[model samples]
Structures are given as structure tokens and as C-alpha cells.
Target chain A: MSSIKPLVAVLCAGVLGLQGCASERSETALDQAAASFQAVKDDSNVLRSAPRDVIRAGESLARAERLSSYVGSGADVRHYAYLSQRYSEIAREHSNLVLNQERLAKLELERQRLQLALREAKLVSVQQQGKWLEAQIVSLATTQSDRGLVMTLGDVLFDTGQAELKNSASRTVLKLVQFLQLNPRRVVRIEGYTDSTGTPEDNLTLSRDRAQAVADMLVDLGVDEKRIQVEGYGDQYPIEANASERGRAQNRRVEIVFSDEKGHLGAPR
Target chain B: MALLALAGCATDPAPHEQMRLSEQALEQAKAVGATDEVAELKLAEDKLARARSNMASESYRDARLRAEQAELDARLAEARVLTLKSQEQLSLLQSRVNRLRKQLGEQQ
Candidate 1:
């Protein structure tokens, strides 16, 4: 009987020790849960964005606290504590999401406004550039009684016997595009002329191809194709005699004849 | 003895409703793109699996507690995923706004 009594006492002590350990663990969990709840409960942003979650966190913490007073309720206390901590975390995350969404909305509006402002600024700059280009074109042109305003593209703008305009022609072409854009009512006839070195048939085709190439470039640069006409005059009207290299070079030229601001292009020669 | 019996009766009802609720919460979290990569989601899945076994063994109280914790864990995982997505969007918008500001300054 004495031995049995000692065994029972030892067993009772072991049970008590286990209970003490469980309660200590539950106490730590409860403390952590309470701290988490406290942090979010007082935050106005959290409350505003996630009122339901904050309420749940508070309720869970209260349940954990109430269960902590009972013996053998350690597991229940810890379970509620875990729930309370999760609710607090969910509340904080929700608040952050809401705040971020608000910021995104404001930034989006600002971006749109800035985009509009930038577009307006670019248009104003283009208009200023158009005015400068118009002055340059006017100085480069000559007044002819029959052709109205005529500008000449020298033969150096293209390789010999090739209709393709060289890269150096981009500046002049861009200026012409700007001039046409500013004068929307005006039209131009692009005339291609070749020197007498090639056969008349070959010269005619080369002249047409050169004129068409220039027209294609103007259209690519945003000019309306309907505003321009192309013509090839094969060695028909030479400004210089085809005897010297310089004279032939002069003869192989493209001419742009502009209307008098009325959209009436001169007749093709 | 009657009070003890009542306490036991109260806890012995199988916790079928809590189990279903936990499962639903887990599914909802997964539907929101919460994978096992999320620590909370992994914990939720493991606990819910244990809760199911506890239910099979007639440990109703343990099953209920585990299911309840699992539901909250899954909910926290979903919330964290959404918060992370929002943070990414915030950074993207911030960079776009900064680019616009730089372009505007250059234009001036």
C-alpha cells in the first residue's frame, strides 16, 4: 500500500507538471495574440478599411483570455489566440491594400493629365517648327510665271541612274512635309526630268520612278497623296545643255511646283 | 457528475459544420492564387488534413479547434496574397508616374 501511494503521488505530480507546461505555452500565445490585436485595433486606417476583421480579432482575443482562466483549457486558449493573430494580420493587409488602391487611382489620374499636357506641348513645338520650315522652303524656291512657286531637288539627291532618294534628302523632304502640313489648302506637282545620256524611253521611266519615289516619301511622312501629283518629263525640258557633267547633273533634277495657296496644282508638262 | 456529462455531450457532436467551413475557406484561399508557397496556406492545409483524421477518430474537440485555426490561417494567406499584388501594382504605377514626370521636365 505504501508503494502504491507513492506511485499515485508521482503520477499526480507528473500530471500537474504537464498542465503547468501547457498553461505556460498558452500564456505566451495569448500574450502574442493580445499584442497583435492591440496594434490593429487602435489603427484608424485598419478600422476604416477592415472593420469586420478588426472586430473578429477582438472577439477571438477575448475568447482566448476567458479560456486562459480554466484548467486544461490551454489548447482552447491557444486556438483562439492563433485565430486572433490571424485576424489582426488580415486586417493590416486589407488596410494596406486599400491605401495602395487609393494611391494607384490618384497616380493614374495624374499620369493621364501629364500625358495630355505633353501632347499639347509637342503640338505647339511642331507648329513653331512648321513656321521655320516654311520660311526655308520659300527662300529655296523660285518664282516662275508659268509654274507659280518651284523648288528644285538637285541630282546629287539620288545615285546615278537610280531613282531612290539618298538619306541626305531626308532633311529637305521633312521640310517639304512640314510646309505642306502648314499649308493644307496648297497642292504640289512633283516633276521628274532626266539628262539625254540615257535612251528617251529609259529616261522617261527613270524620271517617273524618281518623281513617284519623292511622292511616296511625302505620303509616308504624313502628307495626303491626293494633294500631290507626279509626272515624268523624259529629257523634254533641260535647264542646262547635256554636254558637260555639271550640265547633265543639272538636267537630271526633280521639281516641286506649288499651287498659290488655293489647292489648284499647275498642269503637268 | 451531471455537469461533467453535459460538458462531454456538448463537445461530442462530430464538428461536421466546422470541418466543412474550414474546407470552404481553404478552397477560397486557393481560388485567390494562394499556393503552398505561402507559409500560412501550407499551415492551413496541414492542420485541416490533421483535423480530418481527428474527426475520423472521434476526437470532436480537437477536430473543431484544428478546423477553426485552419480557416483563419487560410484567410490570412489570401489577405497576404492580395496585399502583395496591391504592392506590386503600386510600384508599377509609381514607376510610370516617375517616367511621365521625367518626360515633362525634359520637355520644359
Candidate 2:
């Protein structure tokens, strides 16, 4: 009977000790997990975009609280609390990811919009400049061809039998220079033609000399020599009959052709 | 007496292997930027420090348990870092795709 009494005392002490240990088990981890879950729940983005994650986090927090409320299971409480904390973190990260994705999409759209606007602005500027250049060369008989802008200088600009340009042609040449300056990307080709009055060889030499003279003048006016191409067709491409004086006058001329923005001239068609 | 003490020393439960493993895990986690990205990494580091202190005080059993816990926490930190990094990479790729779609739409 005395031995039974000591065994009962020992059982009571063990029970009390278990109670004390359970009471002393820290609730800090569970409390922190609960707070983290609450913060995620309160965030509007998380609520709107991460409803499942928030729900899971809430469930995990509940599980952690249950584990902590139990007696003699401190390790279980800590394990569940860690899981709950991770779930809350995942909820927040998911919400942030969605928000950041949206922001990235918006930024990309804005970039594309700006790029399009810039392209359009550049195109409009080119069109307006073309129109202005066209107006400036009205007296020079400018025409748009597949080869690009063509400005023709009549025989009146040069001496009757010589290759020198007349002094009065300075105004037109200056205007051409201004157009070239405004559109610096464009290149020019100078082609000289003559009437069929002389031998083909003589006509070729004269035509070639006249084209070279014009190219030199352009180069002297600050145009890059590499950007100018000079060629003489002689009597090969006369626009009018060489039998009449008026036709011959029309045939003797110099043509200045402007290339495209990339300095590409279309082949003669 | 000395022989008995040597026998007791041989049975020391400080878990040197577990402590080394935990240290290695923590080093790997830190190398991957887990300390900055994962809150659990700091917790693991604290536990590891406690484990070392306990080993110094000759509390071998507690040191072994804490080392094991610390190793688990460090591994968790490594996993979380990978998850976050993958999420970031996915978002970046999605953004790039969005830009490509915009460009194709414009071209059409």
C-alpha cells in the first residue's frame, strides 16, 4: 500500500510537470504567423488577385494555432507556424508578382506607343520637307519620278555653244544647295545632254565637261564630292527632235536627280 | 578512471557531422542570396549559432538537435530562394512576350 502511494505521487508530479511545460511553450512563432497572414489578408491586391493563397495562409495559421493550443507539442506548433509563415509570404509574393506583371505590360505598351509616335513624326517631317522642296524648285521644272526628285536646268542656264553655266543660274543653284542642306541624307546625280549638231565624240566631250563643271561648283558650295555622281548622255537621250532650233534648245539641258533617303537612285525605266 | 573518461568522450553526441552539414547548407543558401530574400535564413543562422554554443558548453544532445533543425531551415531557405528567382524569371519572360506581341501587331 505504501509503494502504491509513492507511485501515485510520482504520477501526479509528472502530470504537473507536463502541464507546466505546455504552459511555458512559446506562442511567439504562431503569433507571428497569424500577424503575417492578417497583413496579407488586409492587402487589397492580395485579396483581389491571390484569393486562394490568402485562404491557404489563413488555413495554415489556424492549423498553427491549433497546434500551439495543444498540450506538450511545442515542436509541432513551431513546424506548423513556419509553414503558416511561408504560406503568408507566398501570398504576398504572388500579389506582388501580379502587380509587377501588370506594371511591366503597361510599360511595354507605353514604349511601343512612343516608338510608333516617333516613326510617324519622322514620316510627317519628311513629307512636309518634300513639299517645301517641291515648291522651292517650281521655276526649275522639278518633277517626281521613280528615280526620285528631278530638277531640270534648261539650255538658257548655259552658253549657246559652251559648257559654262550663265551667271543668272546662281539663284537656282543656291536654291538646290538649300534643299540639299535641309535633306542631308539625299544624294544628287548631275546628267548633261547636248543637241545632235556636232560629232558624237565632240558632243560627248562637251556634255561630260558641262556635268563635271556643275559637280565641281556643287562641291565648292560645301557639298561632299563623294555624294555627287556626274554623267553625260551626250545626244543619246534627247527629249526633242534635233532638226528644229526650238527642239535643239530643249535638248541641251542638265538634269539634277536627287536620290532617296538611303541614297538609292532608281534605274532608268 | 582516465580510461572511463575516454570512453565517455568517445560517446559524445555533439553531432559534428550534422553541424558541418548545417554550416554547408547555410553557406550555399547565402551564396544564392537566400539571406536577403528568405526570412527563414536568419532563423536558421540563429539556430546554428545556438547549436555551436551548446556544443561549447558540452550539451551534446541539445546541440545535435539544434544542428539538425538548423540544417532543415537552411535547406528550406535555399528552396524558397529558387522559387522566388524562378517567379521573377517567369515574369520577365512574360513581359518580353508582351512586347513581342505588340511589335507583331504593329507590323501587321
TM-score of each: 0.60, 0.40
| Candidate 2 per-residue lDDT over residues A49-87, each given as its tens digit | 778768877876776676554444555566567666766
C-alpha RMSD of candidate 2: 14.5
Which candidate leads in DockQ? 1
| Candidate number of the best TM-score | 1
Which residue segments of model 2 deviate by more than 4 Å? A1-25, A125-150, A153-241, A244-269, B1-108
Give every collision pair in model 1: none
The sequence of per-residue lDDT tens digits that candidate 1 reaches over residues A1-269 is 46654554455347666544466677789999999999998999999999999999999999889876655566778888999989999999999989988988998899899899888776667556667877899898888998799999999999999999999999999889889988889999999999999799999999999999999999999999999899999898999999999999999999999997778877777
The complex in candidate 2 yields a DockQ of 0.02
**Cα misplacement distance, residue B52 of candidate 2 (Å):** 19
| Model 1: CA > 4 A from native | A1-20, A127-269, B1-10
TM-score of 1: 0.60
